[model samples]
Target: MSKSNPVVIAVGGNSLISEKEKVTVEDQYEAIRGTVRHVADVIEAGRQVCVTHGNGPQVGFILRRSEIARKVAGMHPVPLASCVADTQGAIGWQIQQALSNELRRRGLGATHRGMAVSVVTQVLVDVDDPGFVDPDKFVGEVYQEADLPVLREEYPHWVLKPDRGRGWRRVVPSPKPLEIVELPVIRSLLEQGFNVVAVGGGGVPVVRGDDGELRGVAAVIDKDLATGLLATTLGADLLVVSTSVPKVSLNYGTPDQTDLADVTAQEMRTYLAQGHFPPGSMGPKIAAAIDFLAKGGKEVIITCPDNLKNALESGGGTRITP
Candidate 1:
C-alpha cells in the first residue's frame, strides 16, 4: 500500500500556450507557472499528485521545426517517435521546475519544495491495434496548396489531409496504450511522497518485438486514455481532467447546451453513444472517466486549471461518479 494516495491530473498541451498568437517560450513558461500555482494549492492542503500532460500543440511545434530544418539546412528528418520524446522532456521540465518554484514560494518544507520529478515514461501498445489501419491523429506542419506536390514527394508514406479549412497536415495512427514501462518507478516515487510528472504525450507509444525487445513506434496515443490507465494502476481514487472548459456540456456550442455538474458513468456512456461528445474534443475525456470509474476510481473532475480548487471544494466543475 502507498503511504500517500495521489490525485492524477491530466492537463491539455494547448493549455501551455494560452493563445494562438502568443507561442513563444516565455509565454509557455508563464502559462505553466500559473498552472503550477493551482497544483501547489492542492499540495498545500496535504494531498499528493501525479501530473500527466498532453503534447498536441507542442508536438506540432517540433514537427514543424523538423520540417523547416530539413528544407533549409539539409538536416536529417526527425521521426514521429522522436518528436514524442522531445515534447515529453520539454513539457515535463516546465511542469516540474514550475511546481518546485511554487512549492518554495509557499514556504513549504524541504520535501515539498523539491519533490517534483519528471519521468520520460514509455507506454506499451499492441502490435495489431486497428488504429494502424486508418491513421487519424493530426500532427502539425500544415502546408499550403502549392506545397502539396513537394510534401507528397518528400513524405510518400505520410497520410495527409485537409485540416478543417486551415491547411493540410500529416495524420498518424493513435493506438491504444497497453502498459506503462516505468509504472514501478512512478509508484515508488509516489509512495515516497514525491510528486511525479509522467506519461507525457501518452508515454512515447512503444511496442514489443517477437524477441521480447521494446521498440518505439511511429504513432500517437490519446493522453486522457493513457492518464486513466495510469490512475487505475497507481490506485488513485480521483482523476482530474484539466481542459479549456470549466465543465462538460451537452449539445456544446448550441442553444440547447446544458452544463453537467454531477453525472453518473452510465449517463455519460449514453450521452457518448448519442454523440454528445465529439471525438476530437470531449469524447476521449468521457471515455476516460467511464473507464476509470469502471476500474474502481471513485470520482472524476473535469474543469479548467483556474477552477481546480473550486471543483474540489465547492463543486465548480463537472463531476463524474460511478
Candidate 2:
C-alpha cells in the first residue's frame, strides 16, 4: 500500500465464466464488476494496481458467435487477435465502470481517484517458435466428435484434440511472450495512480516482419507469462495470480495432491522439472511464478478470486518468495 510499490494482478479466465452458464456479455460484465470491487478494495488501501486477464471463454464465445453469424449473413469474421482486442475493450470498460462506482461509494474519490484504462497491447513472439510447429494450447468451444469434420472443413488450420471425457476443441499456437509493446504506456498509467487493465488475452500476439514492421500474428500467448512480463517490466512488488483453486497443489486432482501454502522459487523449479505441473494446465502458472521471481520479483501469490484478500493478508495461497 505504498506509492513506491505496485501490485499486478492477473485474473484467470474461469473467474469470469462458470461451467454451467453461457459466456454472455452481461455475464462477463457482472464478473468484471466483482473483480473490480476486490481490486478497488486494494486501491482504497492505497496501493497502485495493474491488471491482466485471460480471455479463453470470452474469445471462444466470440469466435463461435462470429462463425454462426457468418453463416446467416456473409459478414467477414474477425481474426483471433481482433477478438482479443474486443474482449479487452469490453472487459476493460466493465472493470472501469465498476471500479469507478465502487471508489465513489467508498468516499475515496476525494483522496484517491480510481481510473481504469484498457490498452490494446501487442506481445512480441518468435516467428519460428516451436509452439507453432506443435500447437497445443486449446481455444474456442468444445465440440463432439461428430462435429469435428465440419469444423475441420471450416477451419482447416485448427488443431483439434480430444479431452479425457469432454469433446475436442480448437488449439492454437501459444508462444512465449518476449516483449510487451505497451509497457511504457502501462508504466505511465501506473505512475498516474490509475488502475490499468492491459494485456488482455496475453496481448494480441505479434511478430516482426521482414520489412521491419510489427505485424499481428495468429497466435495466443499464455496469460500468466504475459502477466509476469508485465510485472517485471513495471517492477511491481507483488504478482497475484487469481485461479480457481485457493492454493496451488502438487499432484493436483490426484489422490496424493498436496496443497502448498508457500514455496520458494527453487522448490517450484524442482516440481516443474519433475513434471509435477503439466504444461496443458498448471505448468504455465508455475513457470510464470518462477520467471517473475527469477527476474528480481519480491513475491508472487497464486489464489482464487474470492480468497484474494485472505491470501494476501494471511499468506493463504501458494506464495513464491525470493
Candidate 3:
C-alpha cells in the first residue's frame, strides 16, 4: 500500500439496514452494494481502507429470530456472542460480495484486486468491568411489559429495561474494549492490500482466563470504541465514523439544534459533559473521536456514508482533532 493510503472507516448501522425495513438478507446486500460503491470510489482515489460496522439492528434481528425459532420448535436458542459472530459473517459476506462486484464493474480484475476480508475478532476486556455490574447498552428485541417476567426468568443475566415512550428492551453489559486480539491478523491482511472488516459488534467481547485462554463473555463492547482502537492500532491517518445523521449536532432533534462542522477533542468532551450527546446514541461516537484524536490521529470524521468524500475534502461533518 502507498504511504499516503491509510484510513479506517466505521460505517453506521443505517448504511447496512434501514429503520423502515425488516433487514432481510436481500435488503442487506442491496444496502451493502450502495455502501461499497462509496468505498470503491475512495479506493479508486488511491486510499487503502479498513472498514468496521455497527451490528446492533442486525444482531437484534438474529436474536429475535432465534427466540422465535426456539418457541416454535424447541430449538436451542443461540447465545448473544454467537449472534454477533453470525452478523460478522452475514454482513461481511454482503460487504465482500458488493465490494467485489463494484470493483469488477469499475474494470478492476476479479482476482487479487480490491479484495475484502472479515476476521472474527475477539476484543479483550476485564471480566469484572463495572459495566457488567450495571448493564446500560440496549440490545435484542423490544418487548411489552407483560413479556418481561418470562424473559427475565429464562435469561437471568439479562437486564430488562424500559425505554422512554417505547417498549422494554434488554440491556447488556457494554464494557470498554481493551485490545483487538486479531489486530496482527488485520494488519497482515491490510498489508496484503485487502480491505479488512473486523470487530463487528465490538468484537464478541472476551476475557483471558486464568488458564491463559480467551473466552467469550456475555457482554457487548461499544462499536465506536472498538473502531477507535482498531484505527489507532492500524495507525490510520483518518478515522471516519458514518452515522444516520449527516453530522453531529448539539441539542439534537430540538428546534435549537446546531450541526458541528469541526471541533477539538476538548470541545467535544465539554459538549459530552454538557449532555449534548445522549449516552444511548451519539455520546459514544463523540467519545470515540476524542479518544482517537487524543492518541494522535490526524483527524476523525463523523458523517453519513454519502457524505464521506465531502467530509474528507471540504472539512464537512464533525471533525475532531487533538
Of candidate 3, the 10-residue stretch with the lowest lDDT total is: 1-10
User: Candidate 1, residues 1-322: lDDT per residue as tens digits?
Assistant: 5456799999999899988898988899899999988998888888889999999888888888888899899888898899889989988999999998888878874874356989999999998999889988888787888999987898799888888999888889899988999999998888888899999989899999999999998899999999999999988999999999999999999999999999999999999999999999999999999999999999999999999999998988999999
Maximum-TM-score candidate: 1
Q: How high a TM-score does candidate 3 get?
A: 0.93
Residue 294, candidate 2: Cα error in Å is: 0.5
Write the residue-wise lDDT of candidate 3 on 1-322 in tens digits: 5433368889876568854654688887887887878788777777777888888888888888888897799888888888888888878777877887788788764545477778888889998899999888787777898998888788887788887769998888988899999887888877777877788777888899999998887777899999999998778879988888888999989999999987889998999999999887899989999988888798988888888888777877788888
Task: At residue 196, give the lDDT of candidate 3.
Answer: 75
Which of 1 and 3 is the better model by lDDT?
1
lDDT for model 2: 0.83
Error of 3 at 13 (Å): 1.6
Which numbered prediction scores highest in lDDT against the true structure? Answer: 1
Q: Rank the candidates by TM-score, best first.
A: 1, 3, 2
Q: How big is the positional error of residue 86 in model 3, measured in Å on the Cα after superposition?
A: 0.4
lDDT of each: 0.91, 0.83, 0.83
